[model samples]
Target: MTNPSTLPDFDHPPGTDLWVFAYGSLMWNPGFPFVEKREGLLRGYHRGFCIYSHQHRGTPERPGAVLGLDRGGACRGMVFRVEAAAVPDVLRYLWQREMAYRVYIPRRLRVRTDQGDVRALTFTADPAHSQYCGRLGLDGTASLIRQGVGQSGRNVDYLSSLIDHLAELGIEDQGLRELAARI
Candidate 1:
Protein backbone atom coordinates (compact mmCIF):
# COMPACT_ATOMS: atom_id res chain seq x y z
CA MET A 1 0.00 0.00 0.00
CA THR A 2 1.21 3.49 -0.72
CA ASN A 3 1.96 5.52 2.41
CA PRO A 4 -1.11 7.42 3.60
CA SER A 5 1.15 10.14 4.98
CA THR A 6 2.22 11.42 1.58
CA LEU A 7 0.18 13.90 -0.43
CA PRO A 8 -1.54 12.71 -3.58
CA ASP A 9 -0.73 14.17 -6.95
CA PHE A 10 -4.05 15.70 -7.95
CA ASP A 11 -2.87 15.83 -11.52
CA HIS A 12 -2.92 12.10 -12.16
CA PRO A 13 -2.91 11.02 -15.81
CA PRO A 14 -6.10 10.12 -17.59
CA GLY A 15 -7.57 6.62 -17.23
CA THR A 16 -6.63 6.43 -13.54
CA ASP A 17 -9.65 5.52 -11.44
CA LEU A 18 -9.94 7.76 -8.37
CA TRP A 19 -11.78 7.17 -5.14
CA VAL A 20 -12.51 10.18 -2.97
CA PHE A 21 -13.71 10.19 0.62
CA ALA A 22 -16.16 12.98 1.38
CA TYR A 23 -16.82 14.01 4.98
CA GLY A 24 -18.22 17.55 4.97
CA SER A 25 -19.24 19.90 2.20
CA LEU A 26 -18.05 17.36 -0.29
CA MET A 27 -20.51 14.93 1.19
CA TRP A 28 -23.37 17.26 0.41
CA ASN A 29 -21.91 19.08 -2.58
CA PRO A 30 -19.26 17.03 -4.32
CA GLY A 31 -19.05 19.59 -7.16
CA PHE A 32 -17.86 16.79 -9.41
CA PRO A 33 -19.27 13.88 -11.27
CA PHE A 34 -18.88 10.32 -10.01
CA VAL A 35 -19.97 6.99 -11.36
CA GLU A 36 -21.04 5.71 -7.93
CA LYS A 37 -21.29 6.63 -4.28
CA ARG A 38 -21.54 4.38 -1.24
CA GLU A 39 -21.85 4.74 2.49
CA GLY A 40 -18.39 4.29 3.90
CA LEU A 41 -16.68 4.55 7.25
CA LEU A 42 -13.11 5.59 7.91
CA ARG A 43 -11.18 4.27 10.87
CA GLY A 44 -8.44 5.92 12.96
CA TYR A 45 -9.75 9.31 11.91
CA HIS A 46 -12.75 11.54 12.63
CA ARG A 47 -14.19 14.76 11.28
CA GLY A 48 -13.58 18.00 13.13
CA PHE A 49 -12.83 21.65 12.47
CA CYS A 50 -9.09 21.26 12.41
CA ILE A 51 -9.05 23.85 9.63
CA TYR A 52 -10.19 27.42 9.94
CA SER A 53 -12.89 28.80 7.67
CA HIS A 54 -12.14 31.99 5.79
CA GLN A 55 -14.21 31.50 2.65
CA HIS A 56 -16.82 29.28 1.03
CA ARG A 57 -18.17 28.05 4.40
CA GLY A 58 -17.06 31.22 6.11
CA THR A 59 -16.24 34.82 5.37
CA PRO A 60 -13.18 36.87 6.16
CA GLU A 61 -15.37 39.33 8.08
CA ARG A 62 -17.54 36.67 9.77
CA PRO A 63 -16.05 33.28 9.27
CA GLY A 64 -17.89 30.02 9.83
CA ALA A 65 -16.58 26.52 10.51
CA VAL A 66 -15.76 23.79 8.00
CA LEU A 67 -14.48 20.21 8.47
CA GLY A 68 -10.89 19.09 8.88
CA LEU A 69 -9.98 15.46 9.47
CA ASP A 70 -8.38 14.94 12.87
CA ARG A 71 -6.38 12.00 14.17
CA GLY A 72 -8.92 10.08 16.30
CA GLY A 73 -12.26 8.33 16.37
CA ALA A 74 -14.11 7.03 13.33
CA CYS A 75 -15.81 9.05 10.60
CA ARG A 76 -18.72 7.96 8.47
CA GLY A 77 -18.88 9.56 5.05
CA MET A 78 -19.56 8.75 1.44
CA VAL A 79 -17.06 7.04 -0.81
CA PHE A 80 -17.18 8.27 -4.37
CA ARG A 81 -16.17 5.87 -7.12
CA VAL A 82 -14.99 7.79 -10.11
CA GLU A 83 -14.32 6.53 -13.57
CA ALA A 84 -10.70 5.93 -14.47
CA ALA A 85 -10.86 8.23 -17.45
CA ALA A 86 -12.14 11.14 -15.39
CA VAL A 87 -9.66 10.96 -12.56
CA PRO A 88 -7.58 13.96 -13.54
CA ASP A 89 -10.46 16.36 -14.09
CA VAL A 90 -12.35 15.18 -11.01
CA LEU A 91 -9.26 15.43 -8.82
CA ARG A 92 -8.57 18.94 -10.00
CA TYR A 93 -12.09 19.99 -9.03
CA LEU A 94 -11.75 18.42 -5.59
CA TRP A 95 -8.40 20.02 -5.02
CA GLN A 96 -9.75 23.43 -5.87
CA ARG A 97 -12.73 23.08 -3.58
CA GLU A 98 -11.06 21.36 -0.61
CA MET A 99 -7.78 23.22 -0.74
CA ALA A 100 -9.70 26.44 -0.22
CA TYR A 101 -8.85 26.08 3.47
CA ARG A 102 -5.13 25.84 2.72
CA VAL A 103 -4.58 24.18 6.11
CA TYR A 104 -5.38 20.71 4.84
CA ILE A 105 -2.92 18.14 3.64
CA PRO A 106 -4.38 15.75 1.12
CA ARG A 107 -3.62 12.08 1.81
CA ARG A 108 -4.90 8.64 1.09
CA LEU A 109 -7.57 7.36 3.51
CA ARG A 110 -8.63 3.78 4.17
CA VAL A 111 -12.40 3.70 3.82
CA ARG A 112 -14.65 0.77 4.74
CA THR A 113 -17.15 0.24 1.97
CA ASP A 114 -19.88 -2.35 1.60
CA GLN A 115 -17.66 -4.34 -0.72
CA GLY A 116 -14.85 -3.97 1.85
CA ASP A 117 -12.22 -1.42 2.73
CA VAL A 118 -10.50 0.56 0.02
CA ARG A 119 -7.76 3.11 -0.14
CA ALA A 120 -9.00 6.53 -1.23
CA LEU A 121 -7.68 10.06 -1.39
CA THR A 122 -8.95 12.53 1.21
CA PHE A 123 -7.90 15.75 2.88
CA THR A 124 -6.80 15.94 6.51
CA ALA A 125 -5.80 18.72 8.83
CA ASP A 126 -2.28 20.06 8.92
CA PRO A 127 -1.43 20.71 12.56
CA ALA A 128 1.02 23.44 11.70
CA HIS A 129 -1.51 25.50 9.74
CA SER A 130 -3.11 28.49 11.41
CA GLN A 131 -6.60 27.40 10.29
CA TYR A 132 -6.63 24.39 12.57
CA CYS A 133 -9.43 24.76 15.16
CA GLY A 134 -8.70 21.49 16.89
CA ARG A 135 -11.57 19.91 18.81
CA LEU A 136 -14.29 21.86 20.55
CA GLY A 137 -16.52 20.99 23.50
CA LEU A 138 -20.20 20.34 22.88
CA ASP A 139 -21.30 23.76 24.05
CA GLY A 140 -18.68 25.57 22.08
CA THR A 141 -19.41 23.55 19.01
CA ALA A 142 -23.16 23.98 19.41
CA SER A 143 -22.78 27.72 19.51
CA LEU A 144 -21.14 27.70 16.13
CA ILE A 145 -23.55 25.17 14.69
CA ARG A 146 -26.52 27.18 15.87
CA GLN A 147 -25.32 30.41 14.30
CA GLY A 148 -24.13 29.65 10.79
CA VAL A 149 -24.42 32.92 8.92
CA GLY A 150 -20.81 33.87 8.59
CA GLN A 151 -19.22 32.48 5.47
CA SER A 152 -20.52 29.01 4.65
CA GLY A 153 -24.21 29.62 5.09
CA ARG A 154 -25.99 28.59 8.32
CA ASN A 155 -24.30 26.30 10.80
CA VAL A 156 -27.65 24.61 11.29
CA ASP A 157 -27.67 23.62 7.63
CA TYR A 158 -24.32 21.90 7.89
CA LEU A 159 -25.27 19.91 10.99
CA SER A 160 -28.75 19.14 9.72
CA SER A 161 -27.41 17.82 6.43
CA LEU A 162 -25.01 15.49 8.21
CA ILE A 163 -27.72 14.31 10.56
CA ASP A 164 -30.09 13.66 7.70
CA HIS A 165 -27.46 11.77 5.77
CA LEU A 166 -26.56 9.67 8.80
CA ALA A 167 -30.19 8.85 9.38
CA GLU A 168 -30.55 7.68 5.79
CA LEU A 169 -27.69 5.26 6.50
CA GLY A 170 -29.16 4.24 9.89
CA ILE A 171 -26.14 5.70 11.65
CA GLU A 172 -26.10 7.99 14.65
CA ASP A 173 -23.73 10.53 16.07
CA GLN A 174 -24.77 10.99 19.67
CA GLY A 175 -22.56 13.99 20.20
CA LEU A 176 -23.89 15.70 17.11
CA ARG A 177 -27.48 14.85 17.94
CA GLU A 178 -27.21 16.21 21.47
CA LEU A 179 -25.60 19.35 20.20
CA ALA A 180 -28.27 19.76 17.54
CA ALA A 181 -30.99 19.60 20.18
CA ARG A 182 -29.34 22.37 22.12
CA ILE A 183 -29.16 24.42 18.93
Candidate 2:
Protein backbone atom coordinates (compact mmCIF):
# COMPACT_ATOMS: atom_id res chain seq x y z
CA MET A 1 0.00 0.00 0.00
CA THR A 2 1.27 3.46 -0.84
CA ASN A 3 1.66 5.95 1.93
CA PRO A 4 -0.70 8.75 1.04
CA SER A 5 1.64 11.33 2.50
CA THR A 6 4.59 10.10 0.43
CA LEU A 7 2.87 10.28 -2.92
CA PRO A 8 4.12 12.88 -5.36
CA ASP A 9 2.57 16.29 -4.82
CA PHE A 10 -0.52 16.76 -6.98
CA ASP A 11 -0.47 20.49 -6.38
CA HIS A 12 1.71 21.04 -9.44
CA PRO A 13 0.82 19.07 -12.55
CA PRO A 14 -0.53 15.62 -11.89
CA GLY A 15 -2.48 16.61 -8.76
CA THR A 16 -1.35 13.94 -6.36
CA ASP A 17 -2.77 13.08 -2.93
CA LEU A 18 -6.33 13.15 -4.13
CA TRP A 19 -8.71 11.98 -1.44
CA VAL A 20 -12.38 11.13 -1.86
CA PHE A 21 -15.14 10.66 0.70
CA ALA A 22 -17.50 7.73 0.23
CA TYR A 23 -20.82 7.77 2.06
CA GLY A 24 -23.37 5.55 0.37
CA SER A 25 -22.87 3.51 -2.78
CA LEU A 26 -19.38 4.89 -3.03
CA MET A 27 -18.56 3.10 0.20
CA TRP A 28 -19.19 -0.23 -1.50
CA ASN A 29 -18.24 0.85 -5.02
CA PRO A 30 -15.92 3.82 -5.48
CA GLY A 31 -15.58 3.06 -9.23
CA PHE A 32 -11.99 4.27 -9.10
CA PRO A 33 -8.53 2.86 -8.60
CA PHE A 34 -7.37 3.81 -5.14
CA VAL A 35 -4.21 3.10 -3.17
CA GLU A 36 -5.77 3.00 0.29
CA LYS A 37 -9.11 3.11 2.09
CA ARG A 38 -9.59 4.02 5.71
CA GLU A 39 -12.57 4.36 8.00
CA GLY A 40 -12.81 8.09 8.46
CA LEU A 41 -15.03 10.63 10.17
CA LEU A 42 -16.31 14.04 9.15
CA ARG A 43 -17.19 16.41 11.92
CA GLY A 44 -20.03 18.92 11.99
CA TYR A 45 -21.78 17.01 9.23
CA HIS A 46 -24.18 14.10 9.37
CA ARG A 47 -25.83 11.97 6.73
CA GLY A 48 -29.39 12.88 5.91
CA PHE A 49 -32.11 12.16 3.37
CA CYS A 50 -31.82 15.51 1.71
CA ILE A 51 -31.37 14.69 -1.96
CA TYR A 52 -34.22 13.99 -4.34
CA SER A 53 -33.68 11.22 -6.79
CA HIS A 54 -33.95 11.99 -10.48
CA GLN A 55 -32.31 9.54 -12.91
CA HIS A 56 -28.95 8.69 -11.44
CA ARG A 57 -30.23 6.58 -8.58
CA GLY A 58 -33.95 6.74 -9.15
CA THR A 59 -36.47 7.98 -11.63
CA PRO A 60 -37.49 11.63 -11.61
CA GLU A 61 -41.14 10.65 -11.67
CA ARG A 62 -40.72 8.66 -8.45
CA PRO A 63 -37.88 10.27 -6.59
CA GLY A 64 -36.47 9.36 -3.17
CA ALA A 65 -33.97 10.76 -0.72
CA VAL A 66 -30.35 9.60 -0.88
CA LEU A 67 -27.76 10.21 1.79
CA GLY A 68 -25.96 13.54 1.98
CA LEU A 69 -23.64 15.20 4.47
CA ASP A 70 -25.57 17.94 6.20
CA ARG A 71 -24.53 20.25 9.00
CA GLY A 72 -24.46 18.93 12.62
CA GLY A 73 -23.20 15.72 14.29
CA ALA A 74 -20.69 13.63 12.30
CA CYS A 75 -20.48 11.32 9.31
CA ARG A 76 -18.67 8.00 9.22
CA GLY A 77 -17.46 6.77 5.87
CA MET A 78 -14.41 5.75 3.89
CA VAL A 79 -11.63 7.90 2.47
CA PHE A 80 -10.05 6.85 -0.78
CA ARG A 81 -6.51 7.84 -1.70
CA VAL A 82 -6.41 8.05 -5.49
CA GLU A 83 -3.56 8.62 -7.87
CA ALA A 84 -2.92 12.03 -9.29
CA ALA A 85 -2.64 10.75 -12.87
CA ALA A 86 -6.07 9.22 -12.54
CA VAL A 87 -7.90 12.28 -11.16
CA PRO A 88 -9.37 13.52 -14.44
CA ASP A 89 -10.63 10.16 -15.57
CA VAL A 90 -11.95 9.32 -12.12
CA LEU A 91 -13.68 12.68 -11.82
CA ARG A 92 -15.29 12.27 -15.19
CA TYR A 93 -16.60 8.88 -14.22
CA LEU A 94 -18.04 10.27 -10.99
CA TRP A 95 -19.71 13.10 -12.87
CA GLN A 96 -21.37 10.68 -15.22
CA ARG A 97 -22.54 8.53 -12.34
CA GLU A 98 -23.79 11.43 -10.23
CA MET A 99 -25.19 13.78 -12.88
CA ALA A 100 -28.67 12.30 -12.85
CA TYR A 101 -29.76 13.59 -9.44
CA ARG A 102 -28.31 17.09 -9.73
CA VAL A 103 -28.59 17.04 -5.96
CA TYR A 104 -24.92 16.77 -5.10
CA ILE A 105 -22.37 19.57 -5.11
CA PRO A 106 -18.77 18.46 -4.88
CA ARG A 107 -16.70 20.14 -2.21
CA ARG A 108 -13.51 19.72 -0.24
CA LEU A 109 -13.97 18.17 3.20
CA ARG A 110 -11.84 17.37 6.19
CA VAL A 111 -11.56 13.61 6.87
CA ARG A 112 -10.29 12.21 10.16
CA THR A 113 -8.53 8.88 9.86
CA ASP A 114 -6.35 6.71 12.04
CA GLN A 115 -3.32 7.94 10.13
CA GLY A 116 -4.32 11.56 10.39
CA ASP A 117 -6.87 14.04 9.17
CA VAL A 118 -6.73 14.96 5.50
CA ARG A 119 -8.60 17.42 3.35
CA ALA A 120 -10.43 15.58 0.65
CA LEU A 121 -13.03 16.21 -2.02
CA THR A 122 -16.52 14.90 -1.42
CA PHE A 123 -20.05 15.47 -2.69
CA THR A 124 -22.87 16.86 -0.58
CA ALA A 125 -26.49 17.79 -1.13
CA ASP A 126 -27.36 21.10 -2.72
CA PRO A 127 -30.00 22.35 -0.31
CA ALA A 128 -31.74 24.44 -2.93
CA HIS A 129 -31.55 21.67 -5.49
CA SER A 130 -32.17 18.66 -3.27
CA GLN A 131 -35.51 17.31 -2.09
CA TYR A 132 -36.15 17.48 1.60
CA CYS A 133 -38.40 14.67 2.77
CA GLY A 134 -39.21 16.38 6.02
CA ARG A 135 -42.89 15.73 5.54
CA LEU A 136 -42.32 12.00 5.46
CA GLY A 137 -42.75 10.60 8.95
CA LEU A 138 -41.35 7.33 10.28
CA ASP A 139 -44.09 5.22 8.75
CA GLY A 140 -43.91 7.04 5.44
CA THR A 141 -40.13 6.97 5.35
CA ALA A 142 -40.10 3.33 6.32
CA SER A 143 -42.63 2.51 3.65
CA LEU A 144 -40.64 4.35 1.05
CA ILE A 145 -37.47 2.68 2.15
CA ARG A 146 -39.17 -0.69 1.93
CA GLN A 147 -41.06 -0.35 -1.33
CA GLY A 148 -39.65 2.42 -3.52
CA VAL A 149 -38.04 1.38 -6.78
CA GLY A 150 -35.32 3.19 -8.64
CA GLN A 151 -32.94 2.91 -11.56
CA SER A 152 -30.10 1.76 -9.36
CA GLY A 153 -32.23 -0.99 -7.86
CA ARG A 154 -34.89 -1.61 -5.25
CA ASN A 155 -35.14 0.93 -2.48
CA VAL A 156 -35.45 -1.85 0.07
CA ASP A 157 -32.13 -3.31 -0.93
CA TYR A 158 -30.53 0.09 -0.73
CA LEU A 159 -31.87 0.67 2.74
CA SER A 160 -31.04 -2.84 3.77
CA SER A 161 -27.45 -2.52 2.71
CA LEU A 162 -27.10 0.80 4.45
CA ILE A 163 -28.63 -0.54 7.64
CA ASP A 164 -26.51 -3.65 7.53
CA HIS A 165 -23.37 -1.68 6.86
CA LEU A 166 -24.02 0.71 9.68
CA ALA A 167 -24.93 -2.13 11.99
CA GLU A 168 -21.71 -3.89 11.17
CA LEU A 169 -19.93 -0.72 12.20
CA GLY A 170 -21.94 -0.69 15.46
CA ILE A 171 -23.91 2.37 14.47
CA GLU A 172 -27.61 2.26 15.13
CA ASP A 173 -30.09 4.33 13.19
CA GLN A 174 -33.55 4.31 14.75
CA GLY A 175 -35.26 5.29 11.53
CA LEU A 176 -33.46 2.59 9.63
CA ARG A 177 -34.25 0.08 12.32
CA GLU A 178 -37.94 0.89 12.14
CA LEU A 179 -37.85 0.51 8.38
CA ALA A 180 -36.17 -2.83 8.66
CA ALA A 181 -38.75 -3.99 11.15
CA ARG A 182 -41.56 -3.02 8.81
CA ILE A 183 -39.96 -5.07 6.07
TM-score of each: 0.79, 0.77
Question: Candidate 1, overall lDDT?
Answer: 0.71
The lDDT for every candidate, in the order shown, is 0.71, 0.69
Model 1: per-residue Cα lDDT at residue 121: 84
Count clashing residue pairs in model 2. Answer: 2
- Candidate 2 global Cα RMSD: 6.2
lDDT of 2 at 107: 70
Rate residue 85 of model 2 by lDDT. 83
* Per-prediction CA RMSD (Å): 4.4, 6.2
lDDT of 1 by residue, 1-183 (tens): 222223454333346677889887677688888998988999988876445466655566655566678888998888898998777677667666766546777877789998988778888887788767666666666665555465456767877887887677666776567867878
Look at candidate 2 and give me any clashing residue pairs. Answer: 10-15, 10-16
**Highest lDDT model number:** 1
True-vs-predicted CA distance for residue 52, candidate 1, Å: 2.8
Model 2 misplaced stretches (Cα beyond 4 Å):
1-14, 54-61, 130-140, 168-175, 178-183
lDDT of each residue in 1-183, candidate 2, tens digit only? 222233222222356668888877787778889998898888877776555555434566766556777667888888998888887777667766764445666677789999999887777766676365634655766655554667788766777788788777656666457656766
